[model samples]
Target: MMRYLDHDHDWLVAHGAIHTAREIAQQPRLWREITATLQASAADWQPWLNDLLATPNLRVVMTGAGTSAFAGKTLAPVLRERTGLRIDPVATTDIVGDPQAWLDPRLPTLLVSFARSGNSPESVAAVELADQLLPDCRHLILTCNPDGALARYAAGNPRVRCVLMPDGANDQSFAMTSSFTSMFVSAALMLGAVPLADAAARVESVAALCEAKLALWPQRARQLAIDGFERVVYLGSNGLAGLAEEASLKLLELTAGRIATRFDSPLGVRHGPKFMIDARTCVLVFMSSKPYTRRYDDDLYAELVGNGIAPQVIALGTGAGDTLQVELADADDLWLALPYLLFAQLFAFEASLAAGLTPDNPCPTGEVNRVVQGVTIYPYPN
Candidate 1:
């Protein structure tokens, strides 16, 4: 009798969207599970991580590919500020392409991989390249699949630690939903963005807020889909910019490229990307909670509404009027991202349905895959 995005299980299953709908709806639950799971697994990863993090010359690199890659981008900004460490969000694709350039053999390194499957060709190859190229590289792998190559890569290696996400976080859907958010927050918590005492509370608060958004957003999402936007743009700043990238990708993937999409920061969009807006376009701005950043977002939002370049331009954060409003005040942009993400995922799902495409598998011909294929990983010189 479970329902998702206002659609019952039977209806969703009949439409071939059961996986996508259920996965999107279950993210808040998976996020809560991540808090408890990480807390319980602290005994295993904390000792090694504490000492590694304390290393004076340590450089942390977060990596993954595709949607998984976006997780690093979303987190790297805040994690750098909170941990007071040099955290670079380097995609696995970059590392695999040129290991010598990306993986520094000279510095003491901790490679934190945020991967959903852990089996992506680049994901595995990047880890190997790091080991081959760096003398002092330690691995912290956060992934959903325990049996994925990245997890097994830790089996006998004392330099590696694998942390599995909560149940149902593996994401049966083609696009990442529960898997992405769970790993996104998992990296935040495990890397000391929130205090140990406050981690569980912070997670619980965001999860509950997102639970409410899951209910409120679906109807609006359906209406937006019905209106049939031919182009979409997502805007934000800092970590939210990364969230914007993922948001843009979700809509693009769900609609099977029927709707073109672009993402940029509020200020950056004015540079040139604003031209993506047209009469049939939809523009969504992910407003930051920070006062300074919020001003730029306000400027952009007001300009978008005033110019009327796009048919629908909206703000997705707290404000007095016409904003979708995530409704959690005084939270970090890190936490605010979760509820905002829920809205994007739901809208993408509805857009897929409105386009008469299967939300679960928008690409039936196998051009795009749930897991990427056909990439040959060459051996790196030892």
Candidate 2:
């Protein structure tokens, strides 16, 4: 009897909708705020980032909790090539669980914390543990919640620098949409790649494309859900592979585990993991725009079609292809990530509804949260 557009769940529906239109409409405002933040604070940020880069033993650890963690994973490859620095995308969960193995006391390290709340126990604990373990370590906290612990931790601490994302980049929704993309953008710019002036056009173009394309994604996803696929296998490569992980998690979380999902690189799935595919599963491939990358993606595409194991298969990228293909118009992989992510978010939202759950609060059981919960922080003795 509950209608999807019922007023009772207005807030939930509003927040859960991650269409191309929403993202595109937000482009101008988000980019303006993002660029302004860097321009106004470049003098201060540049020196700090330079200092971190100057260290010969500098190990840039991109970290966060849940969706926040995926932001780093999505950027690690691009950052490595742009900065030519050793960058590792480590989860704060893993870091908090075992500090010694991750934080070598001998290595002078830089912990780049990507937190939406900046207050996740794991986020706070990872920073504290790193300082306690590493002989020489610096903290760069990037988050939307400025009042959260991570942002304020930089106060009076010369070793820490906190960069806050633009307003609304924090996302009021249960899921991270614009917030995830903006933070990744800030990191990519601050760490390396396109200058502020040059970044303008690309950002505008990508945002515009999203707005134009996102309109029909939700309907498409909803229809797919109606087909009743019980499982999903998402495949991508490099940066997109990390995105595949986030996409998989979103469906699992939003469906309250009702829709089992798994993700792996294009090549990695061909291994033993291929067994997960069956007639009831939906296979989604995020093909790369680059020719070299697309070759691998195509190979997997061909394999999946050949196997004819899954009931459905969707391929998304920058070119026309057999089967269901979403060809992005001449955009880099980084920009391509936005539209791809929107598809994932829409799919998860549809799945949540298909399972008769609220998209905004998929798990009212309190097992998960918009910002996480019930994590006890232990004191790290100096």
Candidate 3:
């Protein structure tokens, strides 16, 4: 049996976790492929993207459901700061229910949809509603499943441009691992302010850093998993704050509610959410690399340590003495997110295993599904 990280394939497969484990392990390679693919295909989509971005008063809305939705939340801040574009990260669930609240009929809108399966009811409905409500709306569909409804919906449409993620990005696991990171990297490279060549170099550096961290993380994650923490809280700032949301969801999904989880920005946690911490809780803070943001992150880390309420507290970043360090001092918080996320992913995977739940499909009872089920689409009143 092949060994993945610390476990043999037979053991992982018997535990129903091989797919999830393999998917998590393959992210670095997949990210490289995504970067290369974007660079190679820039000619086909760049003109369209350039033209749409060039439009005065263009609103960029990033939409998706579940983990896919978190992608937008993570990227929108960085994109807005760097590109100076008016970008909004709205969930498809929200858009589907009330299009008027999100879609502006007066502005030329670019709907950037992120989906692993591309078949969610809300995802498809959001695209359709944007077209109906906004006369000058265009779509840039980023998805793993080419045959899915969202991808197929873009076929031959002059107003829509669809980009397929690298093969194997369509994660077979119930939870998204490789799919999330691949799509996140793709969008960062294509829509971010960095030039393609520079973006590729940054990606390479991040990927290598992650590869090194992944080698050392599984052991630490396994230890944390078996440490008997009943709750986990993830905290960060800015883009990393959005990523903290996704990281929190992974543990909740993989453990099938065996471990309760919550996420908040470093500064935001001081409000009411800090009450979630207790003796049985484990806290993971994703520290920002930016000097300005790192102050807030460090202050929270110090406060948490000083409180001594949680059983375990971990800080992740390029800083010294962190539970896990990636050593990318020059990298921005956006680039640092990749490595920080990998730590969260591995921890969730190990925690699931420790809880004796199937990482591949935690709820085999069908209450939850790989692709969400039983969602009904309602028509918008004209």
Badly placed stretches (over 4 Å) of model 3 are none
Positional deviation of residue 274's Cα in model 2 after best superposition, in angstroms: 1.1
- Write model 2 residue lDDT over 1-382, tens digit each, in one string: 2223222234444655433224323644686578667867889888778877988978899999888899899899877877789999999999988777788777788999998888889999999898888889998888989899888898889999888888777776566766777788788778875666566666667666666655556578888877878899899899999899989988888788888899999899877998889999999998887789889999888878887878788888766664444554567777778778877877877778778876667777787788778878777666
Per-residue lDDT over 1-382 for candidate 3, one digit per residue giving the tens place of the 0 to 100 score = 6777679999999999999999998998998898888888889988889888989999999989999999999998899999999999999999998899989899999999999999988999999999899999999999999899999999999989999988999999999989999999988888965788787787888888888877788999999999979999999898888899999999999999889999999999989999999999999999887889989989999889998999799998777777677788487878888888898899999999999899999999999999989999989987
TM for candidate 2 is 0.90
**Evaluated with lDDT, which candidate comes out highest?**
3
lDDT of 3: 0.90
* Weakest 10 consecutive residues of candidate 1 by summed lDDT: 321-330
Q: What TM-score, computed on C-alpha atoms, does each candidate reach?
A: 0.98, 0.90, 0.98
The lDDT of model 2 is: 0.79
Where does candidate 1 clash, by residue pair? none
Q: Flag the better candidate by lDDT, 1 or 2.
A: 1
Worst 10-residue lDDT window for candidate 2 reads: 1-10
Tens-digit lDDT string for candidate 1 (1-382): 9898899999999999999998998888888888887788788888889999999889999999988889999999999988899999899999999898898888999999988999999999999888888999999999999889898888888998888998898989899988999899888888999886688888888888888877788999999999999999999899999999999999999999999999999999988887888998999998888889999999989999998788899888877763797767577789988888888998999999999999999999999999999999988776
Ten residues in sequence with the least summed lDDT for candidate 3: 320-329
Ranking by lDDT: 3, 1, 2
Report the C-alpha displacement of residue 212, candidate 3, in angstroms. Answer: 1.4
